[model samples]
Target: MSVTLAVNCYERTYRQVLAPGYFPAIEQMNARTFEQVIALINNVGDPREAQDRAAALVDCGEITGFEFVSDWVPAALQHWRLGHRHFRRRPYLLDYGLVMPLVSSSEYILGWDAETVLEEPADWVSPSLDLLGSDSRVLHASLNWPPARPQDAGVEGDAVARVGDFLLSWGFSDQVFLISRKNMLATDMKTFSPAAIARHAPHPYTFEFRMESYQRASRKVRATYEPVRYRTNLQIDGVLDRTGKSQYEGFRTEALHRVEYHITRQLPSRLGPRWARNASISQARGTKQG
Candidate 1:
């Protein structure tokens, strides 16, 4: 089965808290991570769209190429003009939440958070896929929260709970997960409508939309936790600002300090990074066509 890595990187909102100088460093870190992930995708031989067409859209030292997913743009922009009190100024539901799942041809899609850095090269989901057996439909990571019965659960498990014929998880916004195309398409079909997003602004966090998707799709969905461990530099304690309030109250704005890429030796990757490799290929193709 094919796999597509759908990652969300919203730099505009993150800039709110990070110092002006930190953006350059953050851009470097993102480029490095993008390069590493591309290498891994090539090594694993997972089929994905050739990154050529989308690469040119990458901002200077930034992975903004994927921002083309804009199904939610109309509604979001209208909200912006009307001065809606959404937490995030710019949201990724158009790309990450709405568009990716609904349109991807990959049999399995991995949702990755851009702020995270992987310490080593690893095929993160292969083992979990094997163990969960062919019958399993979803594989996810754990959040730092105690599992409890969902408030509206009709059936409950120690770590799993079902509600209204659907399953709900406290996985902390699904930072990482492997989901089946069938489940995603099912959820897209059942809960969210293209018209809805076009007509009205949904929650900017996108959590409620995601949970509702999970609920409608849970009938055929059986999910398992991933087995790999990740290293993140997210400082949980003392992250609050001067007023004893978290700098990122509803969103994250921490600088990309202590990233794995910063500590590792830089190498000449075959694909380079930040969608540039594909852009080069696209440029060459255009030249040949001309």
Candidate 2:
């Protein structure tokens, strides 16, 4: 069955009057929440391995990650009505959309355009938000006075600008992504990551922005901010393969998946979605998900 998109409950209003001093509190709370979820993910397996995966990305010139906060926690999954598929379904975070971080991801939120989905752990962009730290935050910040139009997205740049500018003012390494409907449009900073920026092809000087940091300046300045913490029940699911059991009792799932990808690679003569029309790949051949 297809999942419907919910109206975003988290309003984008916080940006208009977002004061400079508020970052520490937000970051502290977010980091702690992220860490707790990481602990849960660790309990499921080797957190060190996950961390190593994140760290290794730094070496490979890519940033990879898994969701930190998950629906698996009793508290976290209070809102999740469904979970990702395994065999009989796995335990998942309640708020799988925002809290989960990438596996092997240290700072999972930071990365380039190519790396965003390419380096993302699994289904981050497809059916899930996975994190709140995205370029959309900037778009929300910018569109402060409108019902919002479709073109506003394209006319504007890809997600981050003012928000990134604000983060830069605060002195922390910041990266943001704002892709929707699969690269229909976007605006990105050249200096999103210093490490990655250095690797930019065709000589680095051409990129428009410079990467900068705030927390690393001095111990006294860093130690001054008080950290804020919030806790939510993180959903934790244990995934196990079902082996060769593709046939089960209970309710059956209709064919909701498109053979577009499969047909593209497996049968060049068949143009997936288009071919599906000729093939009549409809759910239940006539019935629908009810």
* Best by the TM-score measure: 1
TM per candidate comes to 0.42, 0.22
How much lDDT does candidate 2 score? 0.21
| lDDT value, candidate 1, whole model | 0.34
The lDDT per prediction is 0.34, 0.21
Can you write out model 1's per-residue Cα lDDT over 1-290, one digit (the tens) per residue?
Answer: 55555554443223221223332333243232322111111111212332332242232333323433344445433432322233244343332454455435566666655444444435545543443234332333222222323463211221233322223332224445556655555453224322122112223235333443333223222333322344443444322342244445423322222121232113222321111111111111111110
Which parts of model 2 have CA positions greater than 4 angstroms off? 1-45, 55-72, 79-88, 92-95, 98-245, 249-251, 254-290
Q: After superposition, how far is residue 281 of candidate 2 from its true place, in Å?
A: 24
All candidates: CA RMSD (Å): 18.9, 21.8
Q: Give the least accurate 10-residue stretch of model 2, judged by summed lDDT.
A: 215-224
- Rate residue 285 of model 2 by lDDT: 18
Candidate 2 per-residue lDDT, tens place, 33-73, comes to: 22111111212244455445434433443321233333333
Poorly placed runs, candidate 1 (over 4 Å): 12-67, 71-95, 131-133, 136-172, 188-205, 216-226, 236-290
